[model samples]
Structure formats: C-alpha cells, structure tokens
Target: MEETISLKENYEIVKKRIWLILSITIIAALISALVSLFVLTPIYQSSTQILVNNSESEISGFDINDIRTNTELISTYSVIIKSPAILDIVIEELELNRSSGVLSSQINVKPENNSQVVSIIVQDANPTLAAEIANTIARVFKTEIVALMNVDNVSVLAEATVSEKPSPIKPNPTLNIAIAIVVGLMSGVGLSFLLEYLDNTVKTEQDVEKLLELPVLGSISQIKEQEENAFVSSQQNQPVGSVTIES
Candidate 1:
C-alpha cells in the first residue's frame, strides 16, 4: 500500500537537514563574493555631450530653410559620428592603436528628442582616455561635416571629467552573491530529499510492520549487562551431551 506523509513530516525532514542547506548557501556566497571582488576586473565609465544646432547664423551664410533641413539631419549626424570617416581621423590624430570599428564600438551617440542636440558617450577603463576620445571624435566630426556638407552647426556642448571616485556600472557583487546563495539553498534542499528517497534502511517499528505485513506479538530490549553475564556463565560451565542455560 502507498503511504502518505503530512506537511508536518515534510517540514521535519527539511528542518533535520537545515545544516546542509546552510553549509551550501555559505559556500556559494563565499565563491560568488571572491569571484566578484578578486577574480573579475572592475570597469569604469566616462561620458561627453555634443550639441547639434542647425540654426542659420550670419557668419555661416546659409538659408534658414537649409538650416532647418540640416537640423532634421541630426539623426544622420549621430550615425556618422561613429563611422569610419570620422573615427579614422580621430584614431590617426590621437595615434590610438585600436581599429576604427573597435573604437567606434566604444562610442554611443544619441540626439535629444525633437531637438537638434546630440549627446556622445564614450566608455573606457581610463577616464582621461575616455574623455579624450570623446572630445576628439566630436572635433573631428565637426570639422569633417563642415567641409563635407558645408554646414558648421555641430559643436561640443560638454566634456567628460575624471571621476574622483570610481564609477562601477557592472559586476555587482552583492546581487550576484545573493542569487548564488538562494540557488545553493535550493540545490541543497533538493539533494537532501533525493538522498532521503534513495535510502532504504528501516528506521522505525512502523516500517518493519508495513514491510512484513505481520502482527508483532511483543518487543523486548536486549540488555548489554544480561548478555555479558550469560556469555561469562556459559564459558564457566562445561556442557554435557546436550547443553542448556537458564536466564
């Protein structure tokens, strides 16, 4: 016959194995903490902003409608800021060893909604290098656009500064360790139940009765003192053809 266990019993089993759960959780948390703090390298970020104003000016000698049209082309300018034409010049001028494509990937350009202002953000391990790259890209883009499109509306709005305190944007150790602890606790509980299921030893009278399907007349305790005494008396007495001992 199948047996049913109560919620209380299940809770008891987990309670009995709480130590295993705690041990696994502690180990996982330690590993995660060590990996996050020591094994992984921390990365820093810096950003620069550029303004894209297409308003016609007296010095530029461009028509108001042409200025408006150029203003609408801010999206195109954002894309061009990261293109090979601009990035290549910036790389050559700065003597950067990275390729145009690789350098471009480090840049993110976005224009303000319904406005002509474009913001360029650069990220690198070194804050000064990041700011230099951002400023260079903006200057190069501005010069190239002025000559190529006959428009001089693009300008640098802000420059990135070196942060006094390191800005950590990735590899959150606390969050990682928290998740690892939860996962480890769950795994430990699952393993405990699995081991319990695989165990086949009879640990209680109920188990013996159920397995044998027979009534138990009586149960007696085997006393160690009585057993020892009986063993000693048997050795002292010599046996005849048939031997018997009284208890």
Candidate 2:
C-alpha cells in the first residue's frame, strides 16, 4: 500500500521535535559566528588604476585609431604588470620578503574592456600593506614598461589609499551567520522528519488501527499504582455492611 501523511501529522511531528531542531540550528549558527569572527583570517583589499596613452595631447591628438591601439595595448599591459620583471622591482622597493610567484598570487591585473585603463588589485591581511603593494606595483610597472616595451604609454591614473578605518573584505560574520542559519534550519527539519518516520512504536488507538488494518473492540484504561492501591484499601475498609448482609 502507498503510505501518505497529512499536513497535520507533519505539523505534529515537527511540534514534537521542535526543541531538537532549535538546538541544532542555534549550535550551527554559533559555530559559524565563532569561526567567522575568530578562526578565519580577514583579508583586506586595495586597488590602483593605470592608463595607457601613446599621445602627449590628451584632447587633440586622440582619434578612433589611437583609442583602438591603446585598447589593444591594455591587454599586453595587464600581462606585463604581473610579470616577474615588474613584480621583482615592486618587491624590492617594498622590502617584501616573498618570491615573485608568491607576490604575483597576491596581485591581480585587469584591464577594462574597450578602454585604456588597467586596474591592479592587491589583497593582504594588513590594510596598509595592501594599499602599499597596489600602489608600488603600479609605480614599478609604469617605470619599467618604458624600458621593457619601449613605449612610454603607461601612466599611474589612480593611486590606492588606506583609509583611517579600513575594513576587511573577507570573513563577513553577518553573511556567514545567515548562510549557517539557512543550512541549519534545513538540516534540523530534515532530521525531525527522519526521526518521526523511523519511530515505529504505537502509543494510541489510531496507531493500532493504522498498523493492524482493523477496528478496535475496546481498550483497557491504564491505572496508576497509587490509584489502584487506594481503591483496594477502600474496599477492605467497607466490611461492616457486608457482615450485616450475610447475617
């Protein structure tokens, strides 16, 4: 037979196990909050922009051809900015005790599509260092690109700056807690239904009828030990009336 449960039964199941569900959800959220606040390392981000222009006159010597040429150069500039040649000088200037590969991993170079602007982004545990690294990479790339590519087109457009109260980009506690709450709620509801389905012990007439597929004739009412003993004591104390009846 295909078994089906009504909404009321589901509600009852959830109501019966609501405490368990709540406990699990609360524990998961707390764990996530703790991990986000204390266990995970926070990362700070800083970015600087560099412009590629071949012409000295920004207003008059510009044309569609120049724009197209500069746009094409941005792609090459993105790669050259992250190259060891540029990153090595940046590391030396910053006195960073890391290899070129490690420094490259911390730096990201991206060029705006159909534009002459390239952005260099850096992430680190320290906000000041992140800004410094981004600005240093831009400065080093602009100085070296003239010698490496033989084109004095790269110019620092925007420098990265550190604010008085810089915020970390990663380890967002609110977002982490929100995700944990959703996951915890789902897991709790799932576990509640699973436990209800696995429990096979019958405790009521309805359960008996459902399991046996038969109508119950009657049921014996359960009496507590103290109540049964009191009833027996009352019967024994009523002895005078019985003796008069026998005589």
Candidate 3:
C-alpha cells in the first residue's frame, strides 16, 4: 500500500520538533559569531593605480597604426607587471622574506578596459605592509616598464595609503551567521525526524488504534488525591448500621 501524508500531518511533525530546531539554530549562530569575531584573523587590502599613456607627445612620424599597436599591447604590460621579474624587484626592495611566488599572490594587477590605466591591489595582515607592498609594486612596475619596453609613459596615478582603521576583507560575520543559522535549522529539523523515526514507543490512544485496529470504548479518568481523601472521610463518618450490602 502506498502511504500518503497530508500537509497537516507534516506540519504536526515539524511542530513536534520546534524545540530542537530552536536550540540548534541558537547554537549554530553562537558558533558562527565566535568563529567570525575571534577565531579568524582579519586581512586588510590596499591598492595603487598606474596610468598608461603614449609617451610620443609630438607624434612626429608616428603612424596611427603604431598607436594602435601600442594600445593592443596594454594587456602585455599588465601581465608583465605581475611577473616574477617585476615582483622580484619589489620584494627585494622591500626586503620581504617571502618568496617571489608568495609575493606575487599578494599582488593583483589589471588594466582598465580599453583605457590606459592599471590598478594594482595588495592584501596583507598589516595595513602598513599592504600599503607598502602596493606602492612598491607600482613603483617597480613603472621603472621596469620604462627599461624593458622603453616606454616612459607609465606613471603612478595613485599611491596606496595606510588605512587609519583596518578593514576586514574576508569572513564577513553577518553573512556567516546567516548561513550558519540556515544550516543549523536544516540540521535540527533533519535530526528531529531521525529521532522520531528511531522512537518506537506508542504513547497515545491514536497510536494504539492505528497499530491494533481497535476502537476505543471509553477512557477512565485518574482519581485525584483530594477526591480519594473526601470519599474516605465520608465512609468513616457513616454509621456501621447505615452501611448495607445490596444483592
């Protein structure tokens, strides 16, 4: 036989586990808050901008095709800026003990879309270090571009400054808490159903009827202590001759 459950029945099942859901949600929210606020370390980001321009001011004997060629090569500059060649110099200049690959990971270089500008972003635990890395990377890229490409058009548009307050770049607490709450609620509801499935005891007349296919005739109410005491007192006050047994 196919077993079907109604919406009301499903609701009743969930209602039975309300306390479990609430407890899990609360615990998950607390854990997420603690991990986000205390356990995780905050990272700060700093960025610098460099402007790419055509150094040929006079345009003397400079073909428009040459200008197009240079414009198309902007992407090449972006890649070179992030290369080990430029990053190695920046690392050496800063006397950073980190390897070139690690330093490269800390730097992000990208050029504006069809525009003559590149943005370099650096992330580090210390705001000052982040700013220093950004500035040094930009400066080193500028010098290297002039020497390698013979283009003095690269100029530092903006230098990253040390932030007065450290801004966290990851592990957003609000978002994390929200996710945790959702996960906790789902887990709690699932666990509640799992427990309900494991429990085999029948506590209600409805369960008895369902299992034994028996109809309930009547229910006997349990006598309270006060009612029992009153009956005993009435019997004790009655005379011995007044008590008679009916056949």
Best-performing candidate as measured by TM-score: 2
Candidate 2 ranges beyond 4 A from true positions: 1-5, 55-60, 221-247
TM-score, per-candidate, Cα-based: 0.69, 0.82, 0.78
Give the higher-lDDT candidate: 1 or 2: 2
Give the winner by TM-score: 1 or 3: 3
Instruction: List all candidate RMSDs to the true structure.
Output: 7.0, 4.6, 4.7
- Cα lDDT tens digits for candidate 1, 140-206: 8878998777877777788777767766665789899999999999999998888877878987666
- Residue 211, candidate 2: alpha-carbon lDDT: 98
Among residues 3 or more apart in sequence or in different chains, the pairs in candidate 1 whose N, CA or C atoms overlap within 3 Å are none
Q: What TM-score should be assigned to candidate 2?
A: 0.82
Higher-scoring candidate on TM-score, 1 or 2: 2
The 10-residue segment of model 2 with minimum total lDDT is: 238-247
Candidate 1's C-alpha runs over 4 A off are 1-6, 55-72, 148-150, 200-247
lDDT of residue 219 for candidate 1: 72
lDDT for residue 67 in candidate 2, whole number 0-100: 77
